[model samples]
Target: MKNARLATATVLTAVLATGVMADAGAQPTSLMDGVYTAEQAATGKALFEQNCSTCHNADYYKTVLQTWRGQPLMYLFEQVMSAMPADKPGALMDTEYEDVFAYVLQIVGFPAGETRLQYAGGSMEDIAIQPAP
Candidate 1:
């Protein structure tokens, strides 16, 4: 009976440890990390001007970032993708949307990184929207 209790305790410990290790492996990355490329941001700037400038500008994104603070970037991406441009929604290619998002991040004081932002398969969900430090 004592050995049975000991074995159950060992199994529980192993299970808990495995859960912790898995969570650590999948930890979310912060938006403050260099996650988008400068070139991508530049392209995004042009796209924003061409498509989104009439309704929104770089300054507008400050409020947006604040509202989205602590949320996954995927939420913002989806929100914009679904209802942007006022007249036409979901009009741009997915990559174009990503580029526009990258541009917004740049204007809002986030540093551009070597990697381009990705949204497919919920990849953007892993990126947390953090306030500028």
Candidate 2:
């Protein structure tokens, strides 16, 4: 009985450890993980220049990104979606806004990734806005 109990405890510990590691691997800890693609960033750049450049620039974003460090990227996305272009807030499609965000990330020196950034299903919330490394 003693040997059986020890085996059971060891198995349980392994299961728990696997679960914890899986959870940790499932979520991204920072933007430097290459969350957006180069193509997406390019699209974002055009959109930003056409819609957001007159009011905001790379320097402006440097300050804003600093203040937003350690926060989720979603918060900034929502802010831009609701209060951008200095005239038409939420005027662009959701994907367009995401593309614009990718541009911002590129300008701020985040590495582009194979995957494009997405706002749906809490992915953005999972990605934290970290300072350029």
Candidate 3:
């Protein structure tokens, strides 16, 4: 009985150690995965028309994206989210930012997938925006 208890304890310890390691080595998110819905992009388009078309157009935004490639998607998202509308900053909802992101993705011809783009609990340090293929 004592030997059985020792073995059980050893197994439990191994399992716990593996759990810790797995959590520490969690996988990073990728923007290639469809992170935003097409409908969401449409919403973004409407919002853009109402909020952003006066100052910039899709073509100009595309150039900005090109300039910011190889960077974290979150950085660009945050930068635009915080500084957009020229007069208003941080006035939009998280979902609004996400919708605009989807619109940008669609404008750039990235195939819209079923999944909403990676949101990563508001931190996208792990997800890199790859250059368009």
Candidate 4:
């Protein structure tokens, strides 16, 4: 039984070590890092105006942005993408959802870049939002 326990422990250690190495090697996309291009932010703005402005106004960010400033855009993206328009959750397309995130980033004063912000394959904790450049 001692041998069995030792084998199990060794296997567990290998799995844990692999997981750590994978996480360390991975590079997460940041929401504040020019992920979305200016065009995308503009497009996202229009979508937000049409779909979200009714309930949430400019002041909403004054409170929420502070807490979310350094977080990944995807974090904010997922929450809004999953449940927004309060009246019509999950109503927007994935592209539209990403666009909306761009708009929110713009509103929070993050600078617009040349690339569009992707909705998946990134974490929010990796980015830091800064005032527009």
Candidate 2 shows a clash count of 0
Each candidate: what lDDT? 0.81, 0.81, 0.71, 0.68
Kindly report which residue stretches of model 1 are placed more than 4 angstroms away from their true locations once superposed. Answer: 1-25
RMSD of 3: 13.6
Clashes of each: 0, 0, 4, 4
lDDT of 3 by residue, 1-133 (tens): 9999999987886676445435545444556666678888998898877777788876776787667554567778888778886888777787887887788778876777787654557545555565554
TM-score of model 4 vs. true structure: 0.66
Candidate 4 or 2, higher lDDT: 2
Candidate 1, 4-67: lDDT as tens digits:
9999987886676446435445676777888899999999988998999899876678877776
TM-score of 1: 0.77
Instruction: Give Cα distance to truth, residue 118, candidate 3, Å.
Output: 5.3
Ordered list by lDDT, greatest first: 2, 1, 3, 4
Of 3 and 4, which scores higher on TM-score? 3
Local accuracy of candidate 4 as per-residue lDDT tens digits, 1-133? 9999999987886676446436545454444567677888888888998999988876676566655444444556678777798899999998898888778767866777887677555533344443333
Clashing pairs in 4: 36-117, 37-115, 71-124, 72-124
Residue pairs that clash (backbone atoms under 3 angstroms), model 3: 35-116, 35-117, 36-116, 36-117
lDDT by residue (tens digit), candidate 2, 14-80: 6764464355455545788889999999999889889999887887888897776656678788988
TM-score of each model, in listed order? 0.77, 0.77, 0.68, 0.66
Cα deviation of 66, candidate 1, in Å: 1.0
User: RMSDs, each prediction?
Assistant: 10.3, 11.3, 13.6, 9.4
> Positional deviation of 16 in candidate 2, in angstroms?
27
